[model samples]
Target chain A: MTTLSLAPNPALRSPPSALRNTLTLARRELRDAVRSRWFLLYTLAFTVLGLAVSFVSAAGTGGSGLSGFGRTTAGLVNLVLLVVPLMALSAGAASIASDRERGMLSYLFSQPMNPSELLLGKFLGLAAALLAAISLGLGSCALILAWKGLRTNPQSMFWLCGLAFMLALGMLSVGMLISTLARRASVAVGTGIFVWLMLVFVSDLALMAGAVALRLRIETLFAASLVNPLQVFKMWSLHAVDANLDVLGPAGLYAVEEYGALLHVMFAGCMVAWVVVPLLLASVVLSRRSPL
Target chain B: MNRLRLLAAVASLLACVPAQATQPDHAAPSADAPTTSTVPTTLGEIGRRVAAAEPGATLVIEPGVYHEHLRLTKPLTIRAGGKVIIDGGGSGDIVEITGPDVTFQGFTVRNTGIDLDKENAAIRVLAPRAVIKDNIVEDVLFGIDLREAPDSLISNNRIGGKALDIARRGDGLRLWRSDRTIVEDNVIHDGRDAILWYSKGVVVRRNTGLDSRYGLHLMFSDDVTITDNEFTRNSVGIYLMYSTGVEIAGNRLIQNRGPSGYGLGLKETDRFVVRGNLMVGNRSGIYIDGSPLAPDVPGEFSANTLAGNDVGITFLPSARGNLIYANNFIDNFNQIAVAGRGNLDANQFWKGDAGNFWSDYTGYDQNHDGVGDFVHESATLFEDLMDREPSLRLFLFSPAQQAVEFVGRAVPAVRPEPKFTDEVPLMRPVPVAALPASSSSTRMPLAAGGAILVLFGSGLLRLVRDPAGGPGGAL
Candidate 1:
């Protein structure tokens, strides 16, 4: 008789309210991002870099009328690899740490919002900003290609955009983790930059050094590269654009032979993990810590 | 009437020389036997007929698929009229010749056995003075195998292997212990290597190889000349291993991007001349490892164009006595990558006022002598660190590397010793005569594109400065 009654719980009915609060928080974060001039700086930098790469590639091809879309995308890939992660890290780390430093986080916590919802809202907002900036930058290149009547593979462009966004998300998650761990905004920013340098640049060097010192096979070098999210992104992005793994050097060829198209799926999975694991850790930390 | 007679006389004169040249080298022409005869259908029948044919007789074969292994003992000419296919049925050599002075022409040979130990080939010659011309060999383990077949000619043949992995495929054209051979004007692709092993005095000219392992691999083969050949998209364009007295000139090696990614790899080779060659779009244009074999011996590299490669040249610590001069080093990621604490200063970088042209050189030629007054040194602390730690390659051409370089320049104490220095660096690019015409033809488009890029960049810079000028004022 006691187990016979099954009714919708009042807490389960408040999903719409939770969704509305998340949207509102996301909107507020987006507004703050715009007000800080970070969005403008990102868009401007991307457009300029995109145009410059296209121009250089076109010129390098003997001005064959910008038909060298492959070269243009290739050049942009390196630029995106270097610059996007830094932008995402800085923007994402500042998003929470700056708010927390200004006592806004404490005020928000008092207003009936849970830590998960706040973190989710902030992540969604930061991710949206990053996507917008990337689209603008890459869109400028596409516009140039279209204006010049250049022959470009649309699928490649889509993949590039997707990979770049995923890369930004991964970097953002790392930044948010740092934001939650650090007590001060400056500390968070500093840690974010150092992490970017270590992951994006130093990790590859360290792997290569290890390989050389240990006399490891090229396969091991490729396997080691998978541990670094940026390396995974670079490999996946390059492989996606260019079917010829030979251009990736020895390690690239080995990866192609070992994983084939599965490498792309694996890299995507790693990127998702990169986004999820850090966010989960940050959420746990945020929930436990007392707001100042 | 007089002009027609004169033309006929000239034509006959030209035809007689080749006819005499095609005659068997050691055998006299048989007067009783017919000069030419058509072969019967089926592989067994052709082999029997060829054996029965007189020495120096020309056997003409009709177009058909002959699934059999053929062995010829008589010195004769085997000519196929049309699309004559000699398939090995996936076993043994397609055609094996033990007879001297045999000529093979105009046939499609394919599908030799996949036994590496047997060294199966579409066509194998064990005797001397054989000529294989104008034949198409496909889907074989080895396209053509010349074993102790001295003074042979392999020309105008299209040779390819099974479209398998490079390791599984055999050499397209292999010469073992063969001396004084000529391999010219042949198109080869998708094979392991066109190799010369223990072969002496080989001339490989005007051959084209693409999508293969090694375009031309010379190992323990001395006094070889490889000229006027083109290799594209191969593992290694031309690999010289433990070979000496090799002359590699006028060869176009382009875009040979593979696992090793070398256009040319020289190991333990000496007394070589590499001149007027074009090496472009490779990972490393030239990888020199322990070259110059002896203390007194030296290899000469001059008037070559090394452009658009990741590293123009990479030298191992043991490499010495190499003379590198008057080459165009254009648009390479790094001019040179030296392993260990190697000093390239001992190697010659200049011949008097003539030196290599580096695109990155910023020194001015104030005297208008076509050479910069300041020395061009290929030394950077960043590059040195990159050599020590290969992982630093991820930051190649990055602003951080550039910043460190700037600081290194400002502070002399941090500057590493120069790897190589050109006392007289060319202010302008190399002369048009020294460079390949293909490179020159591509330069115009690059120049035009660069100009447009500059204009677009400046315009974008302006737009960034004035948000109102940007499209939609979004920024």
Candidate 2:
């Protein structure tokens, strides 16, 4: 009690300390990311193939079918769906789980660096690699979409890439969550991939089945559509392309026209929920758990 | 009055001259005609004459296998006899229309080889108001490629291609950016798709699309009405993408046989009215994707009976504000898949609105009220995690999910009560096709607004940044 001073700690007020710590963590992550052979290989292979396909198609190698914005969209979608997800997931899944599996995380935690530093470092490392791979594909698409007196739809382009990035972040965070819970590196990776697929394909199928079984009408379909990230992604993508054209078929068209104003907000709201709820739960789960 | 009647008769008779002379299938050519006459006997001679025709003349080809490229440049009508063949000699694009008002009909164009560099169409019409009808275009990459030109009619054609072995080939009739085109009464098969487009004002009717990627694909199109067609044995029968004002009615979507099959898939489309269509024997009857695109349009699903499908209807996002009314969902793998946001309630039809008829409706309508006593609100903890991990759907029937659904439904406090009805849902499917082509007359104002948006988005960004930076202002 006597030793405990009635004064504030200097460390709490020192801005340089936090900044220095952040920079140090970032630098360390950069070093680790640069050293990762697997990420490098994956990014390089994806970028090369992506650029080649874009160039060949743009050069009119496969007729006018694969020319112009169609080629660009295909290339971008392929990259986002296949390449970006892989890079982000693999990097994140192995970061903590591998450390724990090798009994290295305990040693690192024992050091002066705090949990914030370690987590931030790992995230930054994975994010850097992900950004690099995504940037390569994005640059290629940009080059193709840009021409003399011809421009791609800015809304479609931005939303496509933005949603992909958001999806990547969500995947990476999920992988990290799996890493925190798993006892082995391989187990975490498998779990992460399985989770990814379920999110990508299965959840929507199940919700659809539920809707059918219950005889849920359009509002229910709309409500249940939010549970699937793919639907959310599609909604955002369609909205970005043309708010007017997002509604298809008898039900969708009617929903948009009749309840024209609310559809956009509803779509946007679903997308935000998809991003936020998962993140918040993951954060809580991670915060409540032990590092090792 | 007698003089006027005589003049009218003369004008009518002059019109009949072209029709009678062009009917080579029924009428034989005159024996006095020369082989190399300006009214060309072979397609090669017709090609030459068409290229050198006056503004208002006609270049007619007689029945024969003319192995040449018929390229037209003037405002002329190139008519071919029923047995007339424009063989490509293993080259590409037998007939090329590059002029306005060019009409080629009653021909048997064949054997256009595959080229990776150039998409070889049997007849590639690049002119406005071009008509390619009643033609047998075979073994070509694209049968009739109408690009950018508007007001073309491609009807009564038998178009097909040999298996290209999945090297990304074949589109039977592709109209891109060509407005007010009518594609009707065609038998198209063994192609990527029967009809594919990115244009407006297309009326596709009475066609048979078989063994194709998509039977009818309307992408970025508007004011399209697809009626009285048959889509069979295709991967996806009908696929609409980023389109609006599409009315699909009186069509039979038959067995779309595929490895991973789907009858119809509507992706990023809006203002579509699908009614009185028969969807039968497929993996999925209709899949409406709510993925994001620019200029977003909401979806409306109604009045189409989905029967004899592996899966009845699957809504990816259950929470999306889609209206599903008056649909008869009968005997399938499952009824509806509401996988997204929002709520679900048992639809009450007699309250002036009708919900989809699921074959699996179990709740009793007590007191003969016709409305089910129980309201089905889709709330499961697995769905909550589905937002985080979508793969959960595969394991949706797992013990964990069952437990969660049971416990979650029991605990009303935690369960999400998704409301499935609008107080004023549509009484019936909107008659979009019947809604006169008012979009065109009203489109000028919209186009003006669009031009303004583009000018502001594209032009103003530079003007405000000129003083700040040079080319970097684009960022």
Candidate 3:
């Protein structure tokens, strides 16, 4: 009896029970995120940026309330693209690595939970937190815009929020992958920042240089955009807000013609792949590594 | 010698018989009393009947597909009863008119030969004083080709082409050496250009050209007047190449944002007037390459509204003596982007006391006059750097660029050369007659909402700081 008790259990729990445990872990993580200072800072930053953009754009239209929501959204797209990715990356990069460094990951692993459950729980929890923070920030501004008697398109606003969420999720997955690969928490954080810089800023510049050097075609430029999840998000979000694809130059026009109705579906799929592939890689890397 | 005489006599007899048959024995149709002939099924039979009829006779063609090419060399009117199609069957010019004082109306002309070198057209007019109206021309190399057809009227025609790549398509309407022609109230789409080359005294009015390579392309066309037209979603709205004495007024050039996009591209053009035009949502509202080739005779641009463009007015460093005045520059990404880092002070930004209204201007109007108290100068070090290195354009709207701009504003010493300066900047935008009325209301409520948001943010901050509102307490 004593030997049997000490041995590993053979029978697995039902799917519902496993799902319950995952949800509980997710809720706990989410609760912790909401109370964190980083979440507050991100929310505040977004609100301030949104308001500033709206005000400036409104001033151009002779100060007619938030009638410039579309313009404001266009202006804030770059800012959100830069900052949200950084926030999501830092949050996710530090989650697993910091926990491992602090010996909390080991403690969590000792519980009646599988590795997949834990990884998925953390991802869902972090994604929810980021989404909540962004919604509050962007939502408040939109409400303010509405309160000012300006016409706002709910569809476009929802689409913008959705794109931002997907972008955050994509960055988080990448950060988690870095976390699993790195030996130390500091290394994970450093790598996370570098990756964010590369994806959000450096990649486009590099692509531009390559385009000039090779005299790249519009199709080639479009194909290159597929490799970067942030670019996909940017293109989709801008297309959603601005019906005129001309602002995106030649590549955008090609996308409208080639993809047409399936453009959104393709973008969403690319974002999902960005999340799934990185998480899968992180899982494989984590499983291979020995526990502290 | 006997056989040769017999052959010559036979040829003479054949020519005289045809001439006698074609003689107009029928009475000329009065303007009020039109003679309608609907029996001719083929274009060849219709042409024969038209030649046999009197000079002012009106022939009403019945609904049918006429596959034969037509040549009208008499002063007669051919009116279609219903849906009459003149199909060229991929042959040469579908309908060639050498007749003076002819009117061709209400026919669908299609499927002309696709030989750009041959300049095949659905309707080719070679004579003077012709009116081609209410015709639908489609899938042709050129829609309406008028060569040396002076004082002709081409109006109320719908011209379309196959949706091919821009380079493969031909001009919708081409007028070569055609003088004092009028092209009015027509719709041209999905073709190369509505071109006028070496044509003098041409007037293009109230036309809409969309999804074409170039909406209005003028090469060496002098004394042309283009007014009240809309050119939308084309590669280039109006391209003036080596044209002189051109006037473009009251036109709306919108959303022509293709590669090398421009609302108006002026290259080596002189003595042009661009006034009261609305250029919106283009890559560059007006791209001046080598306009005003001679500094003494500058192009005049006044009373125009350039809004929502990447760059309002871009000038090559060599372009000089262009007078820009009384225009509203609104919401452009870069107000003025010069190709080279040369001083643009020589180009006039103001006319005496009146200057263009810039939305980005921060100067105050203390005396309650419409003009701002201070001069408005546009151009910064960052923009100069961007001009010098085109690759830096990738970083447009980036935080680094914004930070640099902020720093440039904060520190005056680092400011770059002024691209242009207005001595008397307008406090209010010039009222553009062409633009639709804007629906912007008061912003007082937004200001209040902003205040409330600030308070809400601070409250949230307080909650975060409170010991009771910690992680355990919140859960």
Q: Evaluated with DockQ, which candidate comes out highest?
A: 3
For TM-score, the strongest prediction is 3
Model 2 regions lying over 4 Å from their true place: A1-292, B1-43, B49-55, B58-60, B194-197, B257-260, B291-298, B339-351, B365-475
Query: Distance from true position, residue B276, model 2, in Å?
Result: 2.1
Q: DockQ each candidate and list the results.
A: 0.08, 0.02, 0.16
Q: How accurate locally is residue B368 in candidate 2, as Cα lDDT from 0 to 100? A: 53
Candidate 3 runs further than 4 Å off: A1-18, A35-37, A63-73, A97-104, A139-159, A177-278, A284-292, B1-43, B407-414, B436-475
Error of 2 at A236 (Å): 40
**Candidate 1 — which residues are off by over 4 angstroms?**
A1-36, A49-82, A96-122, A138-161, A178-228, A235-266, A282-292, B1-43, B163-168, B198-200, B242-244, B255-259, B294-298, B367-369, B389-411, B431-475
Give the per-residue Cα lDDT of candidate 1 at B272.
93
**Residue B193 CA displacement from its true place in model 2, Å:** 3.1
lDDT of 3: 0.75
Question: Candidate 2 local accuracy as lDDT?
Answer: 0.58
Cα lDDT, model 2, residue B22: 18
Writing each residue's lDDT as its tens digit, candidate 3 over A50-111 gives 76775666567543121335356667777678779998998889878977887777777787
Residue-level lDDT of model 1, residues B256-324, one tens digit each, is 874466788887888899998888878778988878888686789988888767678888777888888
The Cα RMSD across the true interface for model 3 is 16.0
Q: What would the TM-scores of all predictions be? A: 0.75, 0.45, 0.79
Write candidate 3's Cα lDDT for B222-306 as tens digits: 9999999999988789988878999999999987875457898888888999999998878778988778887777789999988
In order of TM-score, best first, we have 3, 1, 2
lDDT of 2 by residue, A75-184 (tens): 44544555555566666787778887776667666656566556665665566556555554454444443431123444455566567666666567667767777778
Candidate 3, chain A: TM-score against the reference: 0.90
